[model samples]
Structure formats: structure tokens, C-alpha cells
Target: MRRFVCDCGSPVYFENDFCINCRSALGYDPLRADLITLADWGGGVFRDLQGNAFRYCSNGEDFGVCNWLRPADSPSQFCKACQFNRTIPDQTRAENKERWLVLERGKKRLFYTLAQLNLPLLSGWADPQRGLLLDFIEDARTSDKYPETFVSTGYLGGVITINAVEADDVARATVQDELGESYRTVLGHLRHESGHYYWSLMNPEPMLLAEFRQVFGDERKNYQAALDAHYQNGPALRWRERFISAYASSHPSEDWAECWGHYLHIYDALDTACSHRLLDRSPESMSMSERLRAWSKVSLMLNELNRSVGRGDAYPFVINEVVAEKLELIDLAMDRLRTLH
Candidate 1:
């Protein structure tokens, strides 16, 4: 993320709701992708630097779950980001409000990277055919009120459904133990699910598809059967030599998505490292080999830092030769996508 400052010249963060120096209210403007300093102009009115009036989103005012700004000229009261939501968790439940806040923070971070990459951002409400949406839902497992429902966090068509329990620390930790997973987080879920969404748009040419197959295996295999076999029999014995994670070994398409998610992770982390002067090279300048080398070193340090804090590795997966080949395919895909701009 880029550095942000308040009107008082105090450094602020993307998630800041109030400037510490001047005590002015702050709201993130999704259109400009910046945290704007707002001046209160009396009852329900706030003005930006240009004297353009705005209002805190209803979600912000009502639930303290959002810090997004709604333009005064906008007919809809929802902010640019909130307008994309198809369904939010039941806010009447106090626990649901906190979970939804966690969900929104992850969603906003995801949007930050997407916008930085200059990728298209459209809402399902805007274009039913291709736009994206989110649904944060709870199931019977989480709440007695929703007895008949069982919602699994996954992506389908253009909508991403995140199980509300994933936002709860204890609940998520329980699942992590149950699944025997090494690493998992709200941001990881968002990034991985987004890979599925983008795959829908990845109409690679015949030659590119051939390359994809060579690197990630044949995506035409029976996905459900592969997944079932993986769950029942466990990952292939030599998975460490080929796949980034045990789950990535389940299916070819899954391998692609896993690699794609890792690609984003590496790119974004590298950009931040560059911004903070931790790296000598920017992501745009680094070759695939350079990025892999840098990431390997950085990832080791990240794991060590987590270990020091008595937490699991922040990024537990390993990138082997085979995974690197797949990642190169993703780099090619990203380059091809750039041409579409």
C-alpha cells in the first residue's frame, strides 16, 4: 500500500478513521483510492479539500464497520466500494458486526491491489454478466438463528461467498486444525477466490493453453474426483517437489489458481518492500528469476519473524521448480492481460 497523510501532515494509514494530529475525520475514497481528510460542516455534512461535500457511508455511521466516503452528488448513499456488495452478514447480531468489519478490511485490501494493477472493477449490480460481488453469510454452525443454512466460502460465477465464521479467530483456528492446514487467513481466502473469478475471463489462445497444460497439468481432468481422491487418500507423496501446497496438488485448475494467488502475494509484497526501501528493485523492474530469488529470501525472513512471535509461518508454502514454472505462466498471463488495457 502507498503511504498516506492527513491534512495536518500526520502520516495516516489506509484503515485510519480519524487523524491523530488534528482529530479530523477520515474516509477512504475508492475512486481516487486515497484516504481523504474530511472537515465537519455541521449536521451530516463533510467537505473535502476542494470544498466538495460528502458523507460517511451509512455503514460507517450506523455500524462503525466502514470508513468509506459517499460522494454528495451520488444518488445512491452507498460508497463506491459498498455499492458492490450483494449481501452483508446480519448486522443485528453484535458478533456479526465485528465479523463483517474483518471481512470489509480484507475486501478493501484486495481492492487496493486490483486497482493498483489497473484491472477492471465492476459490480454485479452494474453488469450482471461479468461484474463481481461478495456475500458474507453465516450458517447453522455459527448461529442458532440460521439453522437450515450451511455456507461454504467459495467462488461461483461472479460472486465470492465468504463464510462469516472465517472472520472469527477461534472458529477459523478450529478449521485450520481440523483441516490440518499450515496457513490460512481472510486475505488468503480473498486472493485465492479471486483467482477463480479471473480464470473465468482467462480465455488464453490455443498455444498459451498448451503452455498452461505443460506447466500446471491438464485442466480437463475430472475436478471433483481429483478433489475427493485428495481428501480421502491425501496429497501425492512427492507433492513438496511440485506443488506450492498440498491442496494445489488436488487438481490442475486448482494448481493454476494457487499459483495465481501466490503470484499476487509475491508481487504485492515485493512492491511494499520496494516502497519501504527494503528491496533495491521494484516489481516492474524485476525479472521472474529476480523476483523468485528475492521472494525466497523475504519469505524465509517472514517465517522467522512469525516463529519469533510464537505464531506459525506467515507463508508456509514452498515454491519448487515445478511451481516456479507455473508461476512463470501466471506472469505471462498477467502480461497478456496488460495488452487488453
Candidate 2:
């Protein structure tokens, strides 16, 4: 979420493929965690200002759905992030291309935050037992081709499935209303599902698992039955006193993922604030407790800024004492994951 600039002193965005001022081709090099302005070096190769050779990820080159770069010598066609894709939307459909673009944007942002946190992110192709994968697909509700299939945005095994229609604003909003959810977005879904992936990746030891149970409750509890009860009855009474969102009250695993998603949200926002010079220090330099304290003030300012523009609150949930404790556990878990990386 940090601001980027082209070499010509022109501000560029993360998603920009070319600089407006210098017309320099832009590509994000994940290895360097930077956006580099590239010069055409012929034969589909490019060199950055420092003469680092690179090639556009095939997804970017063929489908215009990614902006990441890979080493010119790499055997793989996909970027580190796109390598996680198990299935993408059918690109032959004109509308699916646009939907895939939006989905990729959300996914890239998720990878950015994950990289910033230094978390382990291997592709399922690399490590089928523990690695991650993604599926951007359609079902009966969104396409006639799959008349009996219903795809829910969720994570199972190593794959995260995002129903492609979530990319459509109206469709997502309609589902949000029908489910009586306060907020939902593609990025939110991506972040939440990533929590599941990493949680499975962690496979915590006895001590850490015991700590997690103490903080977030026993994840061993029946997940489906809990979700069924939650939907049939609604969120637990006084859920706001203990959880980040109403849906978080559905299950212990869900509470963990909700807290994990909000942790990323707060960290990314704080990092952006620091990059803009609105904050004196970056979240990386702060402890988990410090970041939470900073977010408490920052979230309020963010809400007020949205109000000034006649928009809804940018962040609608509250992080109560109980939730803060759970987030702290998540922070500790991230630290452990970083060590494993």
C-alpha cells in the first residue's frame, strides 16, 4: 500500500502498466518488492533502470490480468502470485476477462500484504500438502453453464475458491444484503480465506494450539454444525463485546480468520499512513500492541474522513478487549510463521 513513483518523478499507482509522464513501461518485481520502470530490450524482454532483466508474467502478457514481473530466465510463465492459481475464469467470455482483472487486483493486494508480513507463501504446485492455490470460478447463480453448481467463496484443502460474481458490485451487494452482513468485498474475502490457508499451514504444536484455544476458543468444535446454528439463529448474543464481526461469532475458526483479516487490514492501513508521512513510524517498527493502539486512533480518523465525503465508515467494526487479545495471538502466530519461512 505504499506510494510508488516512476523514475521521471511522476507518481504511479501499483496497478499502472505505463507511466503517464514518461510513458515508461511499469512492472512490479516481487523479488525486489518494487515497481520498476522498464525499457524495452527487444524480443519480449525488458530491463529496469539498473539493467535488471525481466519478463512480464504470462498472465499479464497474454490476458492483461497481472502486472507482476518474473526473471527473464525463469522456466515458469507465471509470477510468484499467479503461480498459485489452480483455475481462472474462462477468458473466452468477454465479461469474465474484466471480472478476472478485478479478482487479480484483489489477489495481488493480498499477496503484497502477505509479503510485507514475511509469511510463507508457496504454491500448491510446489508443495501440494501445505501450499496455497486459488480458483476464480462461476456456478449456477452466475452462469447457465453450471446450472446445478453453487460455489461459495471459501477455502478448502489448499485452494481458495472465489465465486466470480463477487467481482460484480451489484451482485456482491445483493448477497451482502441477503445475508445481512455489514460489509463484504473481494479483498476482504481474499484476506479472510488466506487466514484459513495459513492457519492450515501452521498446524500449530501442542503449546501454540493450547494458546489458540485459550484465546479464540477450541477450533476442534464442529464447524458445519456451528455455521448451521449461526445461520438458523443469528450471531451469538452480545457478539460485539467479544468478536470483530457478527459472522466471526459463527465458529472458533471463523473468529480466528476474522481477526486475522482485520490484522492485515490494520497493518496495511498503518503502513499506508506511514508512507504518506501521516504517521511518524511504520507498523513494522511497532509491536503488535503498539499497532493495535495506533489503529484505534487511525480507524476513528478514517471513519471521520469517510463521513466528510458523505460515505459510509471506511472501517465499521470495533476491536474490543477480547478481540484485541485474539489479534495479539494472531500476531504471535505470524511471528512464528515468519520463522518457518
Candidate 3:
């Protein structure tokens, strides 16, 4: 993520709601893609330093789950980001409020990276037919009130459904341990699900599709059967030599999505590293080969840093020559996908 600064010249963060130095209220402007310091002018009117008038999102005022800003003159009270939500967890339960906050922060970070990559973002409410939406829901397993309901985090059509428990650290760690996964987080879930959403748009030209098949395998296999088999027996040995994760080995389609998610992870993390002067090269300036080389080195150092702090490796997967070729395919496909915008 990019570092942000408050209008008061105090260093702020993407998730911040107040500026420490100026003691001014802060809201993230999705349009400007920055945190803005606001001054309360009384009577519910808030103005930024440039005199841009705004209002906190209704969700923010009601439940403190949102930090986005809406224009004071906007016809709808919801900010650009909040307008994309089709369902939020029931906020009557206090725990739900905190879980929703965690979910939104991860979603915002996902949206930020997509925006940075110049991908198109539209709400289901806006298009109804093609636009995207999110649903953060709870099931019987997570809440007693929701008997007979079981929700899994996944994407279908254009909607992404995230189980509310994924936002809870204990719940998430339990699943992570059970699955024997090396890395998992709210942002990782969002990025992975988004890969499914984008795959629905990957109607590449005939030549490109052939190339895709050569690298990532044909995606025509039965997805459900593959997933079922994967869950029953686990990934094949030496899976890491070819796939980004054990789950990626389940199906050709999954392999693509897993690689796509890693592409975003590597790109965004590398960009942040460059911004912080931790890397000598910028992602935009490096060739695909150069970028991968830098990423391999940086990721190793990152893992070591975690080890030094007595934590697990920050990134636990390896990127071999074969995986690098697949990633390059992703880069090409992303370039093609952006043209649709």
C-alpha cells in the first residue's frame, strides 16, 4: 500500500480516521484515492483544506465500519465504495461491527490495488447486470441466530460473498491450521476471489487462449469435481514446483486464479517497497524478467525479517522458472483485460 499524509502534514494511514497532529477528522476519498483531513463547520457540514465539502458515509456515523467520504452534494448519501455493497453483516451484534470493519479495510485495500492497475470498477447497483458487489454474511457455524445457513467465501457471477468469520483472527487461524496453508489473510481472500470475477471476462483472442492453455493448463475441466478431489486427498507432492499454492493444484482454473492473485500481491507489494525505497527499481520501470528477479530477492528478505521477529515466513511460496512464465502470461492477459475499460 502507498503511504498517505494528512493535510496537516502528519503521516496518516489508509485505515486512519483522525489526524494525530491536527486533531482533525479524516475520511478517505475514494475518488481522489487519498485520506483527507476535514474541518467540522457545524450543522453537519465538513470541509477539506481545499474547501471541498463532504460528509462521512452514513455507515461511518452509524456503526464506525466505514471511513469513506461522500460529497455533500451527492444525490445519494453513500460514498463511491459503500455504494457497491449489496449486503453487510448484521450490525445488531457488537462483534459484527468489528468484523465488518475488518472486512471493509481489506476490501478497500483490494479496490485500491485494482484502481492503481487501472482496472474498471462498477457497483452492481449501478449496472445491475454486469457490475460487481460484495456480501459479508454469517452462517449458522459462526452465529447461533443463523441456523441452517452455511456460507463460504467465494465469487459468483459478479458478486463476492465473504463469510464474516474470515475477519475474525481466531476463526481464520483455525481454518488456516486445518488446511495446512502457509499464508492466509482477509486481503488474500479478497484478491483470490477477485481472480474468479476477472476470469469470467477472460474471453481472450484465439491465439492468446492457446498460449494460456500451454502455461496454465486447459480450463475446461470440471471445476467442482476437481475441488472435491482436492479437499479429499490434498495436493500432489512437489506442487510448489508448478503452482503458487496447494489449492492451486486442484484445477486448471484454480491455478490461473491463484497465479493471478499472486501477480497482484507481488505487484502491489513491490510498488510499496519501491515507494519506501526498499527496492532500487520501480515495478513500472522493470521488465517482467527484471521485476520477477527483484521480487524473488525482496520476498526472501521479507521472510527473513519475519523470522527475525519469531513469526512465520511472510511469504511462503516459491517462484520458479515455470511459475515465472505463468506470471508473464498473467501480465499479458491483464494488459488485454485493461483495454476493455
Q: In lDDT terms, which candidate is top?
A: 2
Model 1 residue 312 lDDT?
Answer: 74
Q: Would you estimate the TM-scores of all the predictions? A: 0.94, 0.98, 0.96
Compose the digit string of candidate 2's lDDT tens values, residues 1-341: 89999999998988988999999999999998889999999987999988889999999999999999999999999999999999998887898998999999999999999999999999999998888999998987767888757788999999999999999999999999989888899999999999998898897889999999998899989999999999999999999999999999999999998988999999999999999888899999999889988998999999999999999989998887899999999998998898877
| Candidate 2 residue runs with Cα over 4 Å from true position | none
Of the two candidates 1 and 2, the one with more favorable TM-score, higher being better, is 2
The local distance difference test score of model 3 is 0.87
Report the C-alpha lDDT of model 3 over 75-167, residue by residue, as the tens digit: 877878788888998887888888999999888888888888877778888987768899998999778888757688988988999999999
Report how far off residue 97 is in candidate 1 (Å). 0.5
Off by over 4 Å in 3: none
Q: lDDT tens string, model 1, 1-341?
A: 76788989998998889998999999898888889999999877789889988888888888888898888777877777787888898987888888999999988888888777776777889889878899988899778888767688888999999998999999899988887888778988898888887777667889998998888889999988998999899887888899998888899888887888888888888887787777888877888878999999988988898899998788888888888888888888877765654
Q: lDDT of all the models against the reference?
A: 0.85, 0.92, 0.87
